[model samples]
Target: MAELWKSLPSWVRNIVVPVLVLVLAWNLVWFVVGVVSSLLGLLIKGLVVVGLAAAVVVLVKKAAKS
Candidate 1:
């Protein structure tokens, strides 16, 4: 791998390596953002479902008392 890198021209090593590194870093950040956003969405959906379930239970109890 060292030998292969050595064979490449200086300009490619300088420019392409930095660009590739920046792309990898950018992708990593987006990956984390995507994961966080997905988890947040799931949490919101779960909360909504729970809220609906609680509402139904309360209505059922009120009807039973009547």
Candidate 2:
């Protein structure tokens, strides 16, 4: 394993390492933002559903009494 690592060209290793690191960092940040936005979207949908359900219930009760 050590010999294999040493055999790689120095310039190739240097350029590839930093590029890979930057790509990994960018992917991580993108993943976090996607997760947060997805959760926020779910929360907003839940609130809207709950609000609509409550409104329907209120309207039905009022209609029944009349």
Q: In lDDT terms, which candidate is top?
A: 1
Q: What tens-digit string does per-residue lDDT give for candidate 1 at 1-66?
A: 999999999999999999999999999999999999999999999999999999999999999999
Model 1 scores worst on lDDT over the 10 consecutive residues at: 9-18
> What's model 1's overall lDDT?
0.99
Q: After superposition, how far is residue 33 of candidate 2 from its true place, in Å?
A: 0.8
Per-residue lDDT of 40 in model 1: 100
TM-score, prediction 1: 0.87
Pairs with steric clashes in candidate 1: none
Per residue, candidate 2 scores C-alpha lDDT tens digits across 5-66 of: 78989976789878989999999999999999999999999999999999999999999999
What stretches of model 1 exceed 4 Å from their correct place? none
